[model samples]
Target: MRVVGNYRNPGPQDEYSQGQGGYPPVSQPAPVRTEVNAGRLWAGGVAAAVVAALIGLVGVLVARAVFQLSPKSSSAFGDDATVQLCVVAALAALMATGIAHLLLVSTPSPLSYFGWIVGLLTVAAVVVPFLGSGSLVVRLSEAVIHLVIGIAIGGLVSNAAGSASRLTLGENR
Candidate 1:
């Protein structure tokens, strides 16, 4: 109905002139996205721990099978094999956890990273006492070592959750 150029839309010229909103206004740039929630971090850490534990169990089964094919005697099971398997399993678990920390974490806060490293190492410490088959007291000491290491790892993991926090200790508020 009016004199116009050969075009259906105003094209790049309109875009250039009126800006995106069809008017010139002092534009506020978009805000940067920071780390949001701790849930993922905590869950991921726990998952790492659980997966490591499962692998350890698998090592136990493998050890039992390799050593005790046909049980001739109740105590015929080689303690050395059991100890090796547990130690190997602990190492494997911690190694996998370090990998998890490197891979799974989206936001790498220093505390989070430190906790991850230490927590994984604690799993390794859990197996130190099983280096050689020994007396019952020594074995019990090994377990005590494992327990202390586990508790320490748990504490370190708690620190991991402190980073990337969107929630508080107990409640969402």
Candidate 2:
């Protein structure tokens, strides 16, 4: 037969470059931008605050009605335990929302970091009443309130963050 080196004529396929198609071309998708809608986030924060306050109020009612725990006078927030817990829950939710926003803008894994921070803060809140000289029922009630507020803020804020996100491909929506 013919010698291998003697076939000097190059075919069309042989002349084709790397990008020419025997195989399909590899194309990378355009980069997308993800941004948080601040207004939506703020609205979500307000809703979370209200919900937290309501949850605290419910806790106060349960403590009084079911457990028969009288509201203890606090040097900090005065005598109305329901009002005090409600205010604390609202403030905590607002603070958590702000922290979540900051984390979302700055971190790659925002919710993960947010959960850790909130969890630690909640633990501190729960432990603070125990460190003070309060009746056992009062301390337990306070701790339970703290736990509920923490859960409300953590869950709601995280969901809000997800809902507030907007995705865009380059300059196009």
Candidate 3:
């Protein structure tokens, strides 16, 4: 008998052949299962919120110091635009994280769907300011700031989803 890989070539007089000259079949491995780590996902969401707040703060600072621009005050947002922007940005980040989590569990291509949703939202944020009553420069500044915040939140949440996911072969189906 000769051994090759996992199969053996039985000789003509081999007793194990029992009138059948065939090798035993090899079994296939089980499929891999993927699971999400909620803790890591939330941690990334918190980090994304912090980043969004910082971006908001910097955006306001640059607009004020560099361009000598002042935030327009309205009854809806009150006098402190910086505070509002920061808080809104933080909340937006958290919301984005939730959306990412939902898509991760429900959608087939979660990342792709998340990207499209975020991109569309970012576009809406940028466009909404232009439609409102405000100076071109102020609107442009606000739009730019919103654009940056949206991008940061999206990227962070996506990365978190990827990191939080675990793959195991034949562990849990």
Point to the candidate with the largest TM-score: 3
Worst 10 residues of 1 by lDDT: 164-173
For residue 119, what is the lDDT in candidate 2?
91
Which pairs clash inside model 1? none
Please report how far candidate 1 places residue 88 from its true position, in Å.
15
Give TM per candidate.
Answer: 0.32, 0.72, 0.74
Show the lowest summed lDDT stretch of 10 residues, model 2. Answer: 1-10
Model 1 misses residue 71 by how many Å?
8.2
Question: Per-residue lDDT tens digits of candidate 1, residues 1-173?
Answer: 22244323444556534546343333454543334344665564665455445444454444446443333443433345445645544554455445434433344443456555666666566666567676555455445545554554455444454453432233222
Model 3 lDDT-worst window of ten: 70-79
- Model 3 — TM-score against the truth? 0.74
Q: Which prediction has more favorable TM-score, 1 or 2?
A: 2
**Residue 136, candidate 2: alpha-carbon lDDT:** 94
Candidate 2 Cα errors over 4 Å, as ranges: 1-33, 71-78, 167-173
Q: What are the lDDT scores of the predictions, listed in order? A: 0.48, 0.79, 0.84
Better of 1 and 3 by TM-score: 3
Q: Global lDDT for candidate 3? A: 0.84
Best by lDDT: 3
